[model samples]
Target: MPLDPGTPAEAPTRTAELKVRGLTKSFGRAAPVFAGISFEVPHGASVALVGANGTGKSTLLRCCLGLIPADSGEVELLGQQTGALGQGARRRLRARTGMVAQSHNLVPRLSVLSNVQHGLLGSGAGPRYWSHALAPRRAREAAMAALEEVGMADLALRRADGLSGGQSQRVAIARALVHAPRFLIADEPTASLDPAAGEEVMALFFRLVRSEGVTVVFTSHNISHALGYGDRVLGLAGGRLAIDADAAALSERDLGALYG
Candidate 1:
């Protein structure tokens, strides 16, 4: 199947928080994972990526972040081209972005506060950071503020391993938020939690979008969550961007066909 290179009918200007033009990736002897995909996410906009399993949703996001290099095209984030930047420059760019994976990547032995404090590592401290890695008063205060945002301040002293799936996800969000990132990329952030738990996490995530004005892009398997929580929904299928529409304008039935 040929992947469509269609963009949204109406979108923000080039001043968007993220912009992709002809983005593509492939492995040897295999078809392209995604091809010529293009889009823009304006500052403070929330975007949801939805597709069936194995549709290249995860790979596309990784490519956008430059964790996995794309075969062609460009991804500009915060006015920096991810593919063309040097490592140090890319690190600096990433400092302005945050990430959350499906599995809470918290260090089990670390306290919740410590795990959240670890988020400060992206801020470009010097080598002395490793020698005295523990959170300083200022860092701890920032981490606490992030925790308070997620309603997890009361459990700051608890070990990460002791928290439930929902709590751990909240802590992970706090870790992402500690830097006050201008953008956040999340891959299946609430996948492991139960429905109620997922709702709580989604609520908190949306609140961050509305209140903090953080531009967000997250992948979702559930159509409702994608449409309900995001300002725009982009659907991937057959290695193409099959749908790009306002979340409010799309229906569950409209998205259901894409999954099939």
Candidate 2:
């Protein structure tokens, strides 16, 4: 069972990139999505979250990001107790975190550079997203730098609608990097791409994380990718933290048991 967040005891020192203790959540008349789950992601670490559908992996990510409240326990991220903060603080915190979702979510008519600039919207220091066409030269240069990192600089002037699934995902990554966030959360980022493209994107994702020292927490359906790319593997099973171990210690057979 999940521990109460209001008890005299509070979550301990917030040293990890992300941490959750005794966290839980549920909708009415349904089993709890998370029941007393707990885990920690260290700074500059890459963690792969694996679980069956509807197991709350995405929900946990949301709670960790302070986008949604956990019904009990607590979530701490980058030194802030997420649910304890006011809405403004949460928004600001989210602004500092980069997020890449399953859908590329790029504006079809926008050029790759324009789409990348959208990442700056949450930076809180830039021109509004709608007026990015007239954004300061500094913003453009920053967007280009991010694009260059993702190997999408050559496509900067190309329309997003014209790019393939893999290209779009890379551009999406570029967009996420435009914020220069220290932490990044990605959900099924390669689900829509072909195997070759998926491999390319994942290779790029881990390469960037390794080179830039960014903390990453991502979800994946592929057990092999999870084991190969992450230093830690977290298997969310039956509404609990079923498996939390070093990726090297967990084999594909071990991870497959979580799905079963």
Q: Best by lDDT, which number? A: 1
Give residue 129's error in model 2 in angstroms.
4.1
Candidate 1 stretches with Cα past 4 Å from truth are 1-14, 126-133
lDDT score for residue 229 of model 1? 90
Instruction: Score every model by TM-score.
Output: 0.91, 0.91
Write candidate 1's Cα lDDT for 136-193 as tens digits: 6788788888999999999998888999999999999998988889989999999999
lDDT of each residue in 1-260, candidate 2, tens digit only: 67687766665653488888999899887889989998889888889999999999899888888877888998888889987798778778888798889899989987888888888888675555534477788888998898899888998888889999999999999888877788899999899999999999999988886788889999999998999998999999888888999999989999999888
How good is model 1 by TM-score? 0.91
